[model samples]
Target: MKWMQRARVGSTLTLALMVLFLTGCPKRPEVVETVPRAIAPQGEVGMPAPPPAPKGATSGEKSPTEVAAQSPEAKPTPEVGAVPEAKIAEAEARPEIAAEVKALGLALKDIYFDFDQATIREDSKKLLSENIEWLRKNPTVKVTIEGHSDERGSSEYNLALGDRRSRATRDYLIAAGVEANRISSISFGKERPFVLGHDDSAWQWNRRAHFAVSAK
Candidate 1:
């Protein structure tokens, strides 16, 4: 009977030891990898979005820098060298009579007459011949023969003498091949003396026929 009881007690101890061993050790926690979720910032509804950055220029389109560089630069006006239109118009409108007169006055010598006579002096014939040659060469030119006298005569007498002198000069020019229409005559008489003096030298200058040229 003592042996049977001891055996039963040993079996009971073994069962108790097995139950303690199973409950004492716990399972390791599972190593799970949790992924984080992204959260967006909150804003007011109905608000407009910001504008996008400007795009780069295409091959055919010009950039702001290129457009500015291609712009035309200001240039200064050039000075004109040609004759004025107004002057040319005026010259064409009026015959160049004054210019021709000035030219002939400068080129030819005056023709002188004898004291108290309408006849041209022998010495003045050569000068007259030269003037005739010039008139013949320039057929388009016209002339005005102005006769002057010494202050020794009366106004009426001097004026009559001057007319005769101018007429004689016109006749000589006409005979020397100058056209009659091209020659005009005028008398200044003693009213316009070349030199204001009472001497032969001064009288010689005053008693003269002057020539003025004009474009026909």
Candidate 2:
């Protein structure tokens, strides 16, 4: 009976040893799971985000149309009633031109007269016609007919003859279509002789009507 009891105890000890050999030590318990965290969108956290746009402007900057409309072009200013310097110079030069025309008219030929005669000779008619044409061309010119006489004539008689000769020359111009207002007559008589000689050569040159020119 004691042997049976010892065998049963040995069987129990053996079964305990076998279970220990088959299994190792127990594992540690797993950690608890935390609640899911909210993540930021892209370019957040350690990575830098893009800079914010300036006030009143888009991210890409201002449009070309908006920039052009804000700026305007400047215009040039004009002077009022201002005359050019060149035109002022031209206005100042007009009187000199008129004087030149008057000088040219005086340089033309004079008409001659016969001794003690008031009538214009046929030979003198061509020269008178030329004078008339010149006067016509220079409408603004005025002329004086100065009659002279030979030294042989008496002073009083020479003056009378000179007056008649001046009138004769003036009338011929008037008749040939020269403006009567443009011509005037005077008598120099024997006082202003053209030549100082006693012969006919001197007398012939002294007895003449001379032209003097002026601007109208």
Candidate 3:
């Protein structure tokens, strides 16, 4: 009977040991991959997303630095010795500009007359003829002849003499084939003496017809 009791206790302890071993056994360690996740960028709350780029340029995705940038006023300078297209067009449009520019360089001299007479002096006629020729060559050029006189005569008499001298000068120019309209005459009389003295030399210098030119 004691042996039977010992056998029952052994069986019970063996079953309890088996149950504790099964419960305490460690499970195979799980080794699932743990790759890091990338977080997406957050956009502003109320701002709408940018529209997709156009079909062509967007495809290239070109850098802004790739192409040279130029503002409206940053035009390339013209090459040396090259005329600009705008200036060429202007020259073509205004043909008279050439004549006007040429006229700017032309110069004329004064023609002196006798002290008391309006007749163009013998020496002065030669100069007058040269002036006439210039007027003929530049038909587009107009001339103003200023008749001045000495301080000997009355203001009224000198003014009248001055007018006669200017008229005679105009008539001569007209007869020499210069356009009558192109030659304008004015008189200053003793009021504008060329020399401010009462001597013969001064009077001689003052009794003269002076010329000025302008482009038509």
Candidate 4:
């Protein structure tokens, strides 16, 4: 009976010890369903959120720097020597005036007359011939023959004489082959004296017919 009682006590003690050990034992690691620690958005980890962009900064408001950057007028300008498109077009539109100036001589001064007369003298025949040739060459040219007289007669008489001189020159030019339509005559008479004095040399200079050429 004592031995059976001892055995029962030993069994009870062992059973209790085994139960306590089993309850206190550590468990194998497992995937826990714990909530994960909060993480910041990308490109940031530990820093605080940037202060809300100063009021209207993010609301379509443009800064001075942004406005300047958007302006096309602020772009770098090209140099002056760069090709100018409008000037090139203008230069091409108007023909040069120098070409017209070059076509006419500085002066034509060979037309002469006889002493004290409006006659187309024998000596001036070659001159008239050359001038007629010029007129034929340039059919578009119109000419005016200005007749003058020496201060030898009354103003009225000199005027008539000047007219005769101019008429004689006109008829001669027409007969020599210049178009009559292109030639007109004007008599200045003694009103316009080439030489102002009352001398032989002055009279000789004044008695003359001048030709002035112009474009039609």
Best by lDDT: 2
Clashes of 2: 0
Model 1 lDDT per residue over 127-166, tens place: 9888878777778777788889999868999998999989
lDDT of 2 by residue, 5-51 (tens): 99999999999998886776576789999999975455766886566
Model 3: colliding residue pairs: none
Model 2 compared with the native: what TM-score? 0.53
Shift in Å, residue 120, candidate 1 = 2.3
Flag the better candidate by lDDT, 1 or 4: 1
Instruction: Evaluate residue 4 in candidate 2 and report its C-alpha lDDT on the 0 to 100 scale.
Output: 98
Clashing residue pairs in candidate 4 are none
- Candidate 2 backbone collisions, by pair: none
Total backbone collisions for each predicted model: 0, 0, 0, 0
Residue-level lDDT of model 4, residues 141-160, one tens digit each, is 77788888888888998888
Model 1: lDDT equals: 0.80
lDDT of 1 at 66: 67
Candidate 3 global TM-score? 0.51
Deviation in angstroms for 4 in model 4?
99
By lDDT, the better pick of 1 and 3 is 1
Ordered list by lDDT, greatest first = 2, 1, 3, 4
TM-score of each: 0.54, 0.53, 0.51, 0.50
